[model samples]
Target: MTGESLVYVAWAAQQMNARRDEFIAGLVLVTRSEIRSLDHDSRMVDLLNASITENVVAAIHFLEHGGVEADVEAPTAALVYARALAQRDVALSALIRAYRIGHGRFVDEAMALLAAQAPPEKALPAARELVHRAASWIDTICDRVGITYEQERDRWVSSRSGLRQHWVNELLSGSAVDIVKAEDALDYRLDRNHVAAIMWAEDTVATRDVGDLFDGARSALGEALAASGPSLMVPTDEREARLWWPADRIDCAGVQAALAEREVSVRIAVGDVGYGVDGFRRSLREAERVKVVALSGGPASGRVTCYEIVAPIALMAADVGDLRLFVQRTLGALASDDERSESLRDTLREFLARNGSFSATAKAMFLHRNTIQYRVAQAMDACGVSFDDPDAIASVQIALTACRWMGSSVLRQTNPTP
Candidate 1:
């Protein structure tokens, strides 16, 4: 570029700098209109406006006095805006789009100023130089700011997740805490009804990206549960994510339907509806207990385990060793791990559960009434239990349930099934 063209660029920069506010306002208006993602709320808008002003001023300054590409740095406001976007979980692509849009408008305004200030011949050359320099500045600034956004996003999420985990652990530990402080730190209300769930990916499918998998699961769960605003999602490990919804109750059927549609192999253990702080803690505790029982049966047993359905087994699971002895004593030979004994135990359990009704047990187990009666007799002979004693029947019933869930863990067999 000739000195005359440089002089023309300087004149154009001066003109832009004089009306910097108007120029920035126009640029912000156009960028916000074109890029909807950048317009989140009033605070975000303020950040965008400040970012635009800083970027515009830097570009004009560079136009007026040529500088090495390496010497140019992204303005503080731009970096702050990028970090803000990252903290909000907004994509970096949106930030870059805002810059590109503003760059074009900036160049157009500078070119118009140059054309009016310089002679016709000098205007063309000056405009060319202006566009080149503007492009270089944008490339440099975008690279720097993009890096900043990613770094900030990782750091912010890690810190935020860690803080949330800390608070959750404190709450779960049953320690005395200031309710207001806990709510502020967690950004979750403990005064509302809560339905908690523990989710984990199957080992086979867990090799995929952990963050993406959990994030997708969170969205799916939220939609299925009809959760409003932000729900508390804290990942306790790489494969497991624990979340709570401010809901009176969870729609288990809805969750099943959603998971079926996605076809994502995941197991979720949900707790019953609880209210206030006590409910929050109790719900999570129940979910955790449910998860332990659900995973004990293997990955393919059940996809969604509700605390309500498994409440008794979950409570008994607190002391597996004690429960095992109780099962052995109550059921005797009926708790054998062998195939025949296992079948009889299952039949007898159902028979007893249906109020000692042979037809009802047969219908439920899809077997003949005679078969149900025969199995019950054999099971009774092995265990030597009597129906005449109501307390004995209740104890037998509980043991059978423990056998059904705890499987070989509570069964009386030398080599139990895995």
Candidate 2:
């Protein structure tokens, strides 16, 4: 190309650089809309936007400077994004497609600038040089990012954590696999009595160091449970992990004390103890169910929830909305979110739990018999139920249980007074 053509090409590249924000926005918008998998979550979307910005900046630099034959170093953000996509199990083709689409758009924009700004003779030659350079840059960058993706994927799959997670998933899925081989690979037996716990941070809790949180929880659980054999931990994501101890019993109080002592920020949902491989799978499922209940109830559900305590509510956790509606419908004004209503419901629930014994309910609630009687009468009046009817009694009991475990979720959302 002539010096005049090179000058026009440089001007077009500079024009793109000047409109860098526009280019990056358009590219990210197109990529996100076209490749759904790439836009999985907020974190991924941020990564994608950063990666495109870096790539566009680098591509514009490449065009302005004549570095066609030299090695292309992909922007750090771009490489990091590629590795993240690989870790997330996104297809490499998706990454390559994003590159090609962006390249085409970049070349098209450059051609448009050359057409608008350059003389006719300069525009064609400059457009050709611009396209060639853009194509070369994409080819090199894609090759590097592609290699990065594959290498990360390989390393992630072959890593010890990865293999262990694989086996856990297989077991969780209830697929028939050789238990002996799975045990050998995991280095944790599936034949023993196990207590599984699903541990995760509350969204409100900032997890500065996931490794430390998980390690501390493990050590605390092992020491608290007094486990003789090895324990297993499999991370489900950056924020959550599954843990199991080879113990027939899990003292929920002890576990809570241990977590408090260590100041671990994660909440734990534990399963009832179960034996053998089937028990292993069962224990994990139970923990998962307990975790669901705990999450639905939020922090008010407490930091450590065990299947033994929350099993009744866990069964209904799959449809909390429906269950919430039921609680409100059954409890009536008693389900109102207020101190007075809550006190009434608590007294009535205890009264029923103690089999209509006002004295026992008073003993349990640390209130006098007259107070329990008055509150029970108030709650019964609010519920508009007759204890004489068995169905009303049953429904009231169930609603109270839902309220106790589900907390405010199953309670009526009453507006506060102005």
Candidate 3:
């Protein structure tokens, strides 16, 4: 019976096209008029007329009398009632039933249509995947740079951790510091976005007052920068230590002055807020630069000065030591008006010390590599440091480093740094 019902629906669709509009319209609206009574009076005994439209009427009649077919896509149960709407009812009830039956498949069809409209929907994701790509491009560049990518990564990590360690060790000294797990003891909300200052007082200040400084610093740090965590004081021997400040939330000068009352006079080298790890080097380099300021008055200085202000003067200090000798010995021919001769010697020495690696030497002096190369060749022509000779490069490297203690050059052999 189910198979018979399904076969009838296909027969109905095929036969409907042949039916006359007038005949179909009348059949569809049967409830409005007594079509069956009219047909009976007309003696429509043989409904299977050979005329195409008449055969269609027969098919419609047969469907209306309960003959039907299953919808492959629509629900099987709807087929029973589908014949009731077979004559195109005003309610459009049969179409509505078919829509419900096909609802799930229609949604899948819509998505497929959308996908067809767009081609190759992947660019950013492909770029992101490249992050895991094993290509050696970056590694090659770094190898030529005299530093490995991994080594650079480690250096960056160490600089940041070192800065944190410097503060943690001092702030958490003795019982106050939880050494079992140094990192956990720190209520630290820091990694990147931190800056620091190295503050020192004259040894002349009373030791109790110096202790008062630590107490005062903590109290001040709390009030001034509520957003930042507490300050960490890293002890560097007995003479000095470092203080950590979250740059975004704290003021370096205010903290420095607060310590001045108890410590009497302190030197502070303000460090920059470094990128999580890599940028920390900026802070460390600046801190090291400002140490010259601390050394200006032997760590007892009162003035709060920026390293940039004193960098040029500090650089000239070494020259001042061996300056006349450089002018006399290294630059002896300068009186003959060869201005570049001595300058070129300094350049050559820098190049050789860098192991012929233009990039490394350029970094040490903060110069460009091409400039360093040019200066090296200039220096060789002026002075006599050859690139091919390791012994010559060694001599030059030593000489460049020993520029600080120029007159004591002979003494350097007794205590060589390398």
Candidate 4:
């Protein structure tokens, strides 16, 4: 290297040291844009900030020393940061992107600093050398980070819960395997009556201490199924869990009452009772479907929903666009959002629910028989439906039930009536 180039490198290094905070801040912004996994993860973001600070300090030191060399006293911070991110389940792609972005930003800032501190004639060669050194340094750090990430991931995969999760995933994937061995590995019986459940916290902040939430769910579920025998629970992610218990029959009302008494805010979907291995798998599938319907129904916290009760609504609403069209076509202006229309829709719903008996509908709605008849006539007229047609009555009933389950907010988006 020329004497002039070495002098420029030293001058740039000094300037970087003086403006260390600014360099670190710029690097962090670039890295954040590239590493999307860091979003909404405060702990990971803090670790990344610390890593950037250490990296900036190290870069300044390397520039001042004029070359990169193996240093035993101060280990690279990038490797430590990688381990932390891997432990948090950040993907390898995100890590590589972060490094690439940080390297690019560092080179740009170093070149600008060099140009400002040194003569124009010397800046070009010094900038080239600095780029080479920075690239080499970043490459070495990335390699080390990759190694550390692999080690951490391997360790995590071999852990007990990790093996259980892997086994569950394989079973769910329908891979050809021995069910007996899988059951043995999971330590849960598959050859029995099973009731599947999917549980999750409604609040994101409550998911931070997921272990505590899981424990609470386990205890509550155990109490609810105390008469049913042993149960198995699996943590699916930070925010959700899948569980099942061996029971001759699921007392859904009893389970709902038990969960409602709990202090924790959890939403639970209980599947229909099924027998043996197929039952276990089917129940889980049903539970997952019920979870979607429950979420759409509204606030699910401290609520246990049984699939059997909502199955009709879930089936009809599965094709949402079609269901919305069906509702609009069946109800016409009766599906309007105005208070009068809403009241008429409710009256008609109750009237039809009573099998066209005006007395029964009046008793249910606590209105006079004439009043109930007037509303039903209004609803039928507004909807342009024939009371004599059985299909029309069935369609109107189904649409009303769907709107009740799906809520007004969902219907308002696509309702044909104003």
Arrange candidates by lDDT, descending.
Answer: 2, 1, 4, 3
Global CA lDDT of candidate 3, please?
Answer: 0.41
Give Cα distance to truth, residue 72, candidate 2, Å. Answer: 19
What residue pairs are clashing in model 2? none
lDDT of 3 by residue, 156-186 (tens): 3355434455445344333354334454544
Across 1-418, the per-residue lDDT of candidate 2 in tens digits comes to 5667777778888999999998899899999889987865445677899999999998888778766647689999998888877665678999999999999998998899999998887788888877777888999999999999999888877888778877887787787988888999888987779998988765665557877878888888888888878799886555667888999687889988888888777888899999988888888889978877786677777888999888878887767778899888998989887889888888888899888998888888888999988999999999999989999889999998888777887888889789
Off by over 4 Å in 4: 1-156, 225-227, 300-302, 337-341, 414-418
**1 or 2, greater by TM-score:** 2
Q: Candidate 2 or 3, higher TM-score? A: 2
**RMSD (Cα, Å) of candidate 3?**
35.1
Cα miss at 275, model 2 (Å)?
A: 1.9
Maximum-TM-score candidate: 2
Q: Give the TM-score of candidate 1.
A: 0.58
How does candidate 4 fare on TM-score?
0.62
lDDT score of residue 186 within candidate 2: 89
TM-score of each: 0.58, 0.66, 0.30, 0.62
Q: What is the lDDT of residue 408 in candidate 4?
A: 59
Compare candidates 1 and 3 on TM-score and give the better one: 1
Over 4 Å off, model 2: 1-155, 203-208
Model 3 ranges with Cα > 4 A deviation: 1-182, 217-227, 249-263, 280-282, 297-301, 311-418
Between prediction 3 and prediction 4, the one with superior lDDT is: 4
